[model samples]
Target: MSTATQVPELSVRVRDRLARRHPGALIGELTVLPGGHSGLTYSVTAGDHRYVVKAVPPGQRPVGRNDVLRQARVLGALAGAVEQVPVPGVVAVDETQPAWFAMDFAVGEAVEPVLDEPEVPAATARARMLEIASVLRRLHATDTRTPGLDAPEPLDAAGELERWSRTLHAVPPELRPGGEELLARLAADVPGGMPPVLLHGDFRLGNVLCDGERAVAVVDWEIWSVGDPRIDLGWFLLFADHRNFPQLGHAVPGLPSEAELLDAYLGDRPALPAMDWFRALGRMKMAAIMGHNLRRHREGKHHDPDQERLPPTIAAMIRTARDILG
Candidate 1:
């Protein structure tokens, strides 16, 4: 969370920019929102309406995922077009330095795989997971060549491996045991034939805003891109096993087994080949991510003690990837 003094000008600029969109509306305070990796997120009020503000951090160039307007393009393209799966509506945008965009604050809670809400019934939680699976299937079915996606070529399986490998290389080897071997295995047997689709990059129960058993909005487009659908599928499937996400713990009722979730996703579609490779790649990606974060934590650059528990999990993911490959 940003302190009042941190980005004091942010609120003023946001209010000024938003005012153009909703003339005569009285804009309220802008409150910093926590948890996004791309940039500073905030919730602001204007008249009777509330909106979310995703912006490039102060002084940083708005390139890659930090380009909030790029994300806004995605939101604009997908909003209200895909059935069942809804993303936030783009309300306004400012492409200036510290580029930002305001979107309708998606209404609902972001539920974890465990369905941590005590009031949500087990049946309801299970239903939500299946619904999310269906939503993912539909999302992938959408044309990858959608105008705003902007990528000339899709990121294939090997390219995906290389992308994460760059992150893995930054971490000390001990943190990610067998990570290189796992990457090599994934690369040697790159899957082919699956058509390119719009990938959420980190699609899962936790990323969606839900109302009861329904996923109202799929939030967090920070890492979204055009790629093989399995990249997202495998990532989402990793959550089915509690071990991959130890922070959520095990034995929380109501989530579907990974097989059931995949079945739901496939529905009438044929089974995707080389899924084992994709699954292994998913584990490797997670290991790399955790390992990098663990290194950061150890180096005192990012202070999060919870990352300490990640070494075993990272090792486990690499082992699992190797085992799956073998």
Candidate 2:
């Protein structure tokens, strides 16, 4: 059965668990939060308090440190470590079969839809971009040595290229050649190393929550790890770039250019010479991920109508990677 169809049952499970925790608290609404690719997320209301519960999709095996409990541990560590960029506090965790965890629901709308709104003023859009940049800067500045947070294995660009190369096989046959070409290019010209920092693995406008023009919280910690901070910066920059995915529509007006956002992220530090390489890698990585998701949809392993549009999107990203790498 598709994960979307399982939402009602999952909601019942969450409600029953929360009811036990708070005793007399009433469990109110429980609705799915759309747009996440990895986990099934639901917004649950218990009495007057709202919480977000994320559960592993049924019949899906965990891959690459994406465990719900690991996410909870990261969020718990960040609660005491970083104040500038808000992250939800853990409310409860269930690591058994069909693993799930709940955390306080964060306020504000996702920056994704906000950026697409034409009514949003130019100045307001610019402020939102800057706010996100500031939050990322603060996140990278925080020490990764915080207790309870496990130090991830050192990131190897070559190994990553190999891993994604295998994942590319799952893509539609039409896209496999381009995927292989991108992987070969990345493997051959892997950029030299830089110091690693705590990376919000899927950092982008879509992952941030904005209250008007102010960024209030950075959510979705399932992919959190220690890696080249530029990996995060590159992903955010590509997502903000209009040319990368024209299917997503025109770039938002007044949003900071990539150079400006990079400056904001770097602050007093010298500009990264390998930023372009990282950006190219980010495009390739995202393309491979989309390709994999499309495969799942085609195989009936997952269900989402939106996955229908991913082929052209993945193709566009592959073309972007080629241009950037050239």
Query: Whose TM-score is greatest here?
Result: 1
Lowest summed lDDT across 10 adjacent residues in model 1 is found at 113-122
lDDT per residue as tens, model 2, 204-257: 767877778877778878778887777788888876666666465465666788
Native-referenced Cα lDDT, model 2 = 0.75
* lDDT, model 1, position 28: 77
Q: What TM-score against the true fold does each predicted structure earn? A: 0.91, 0.82
Model 1, CA-based lDDT: 0.81
Error of 1 at 84 (Å): 5.2
Cα lDDT, all candidates: 0.81, 0.75
Q: In angstroms, how far off is 219's CA in candidate 1?
A: 0.8
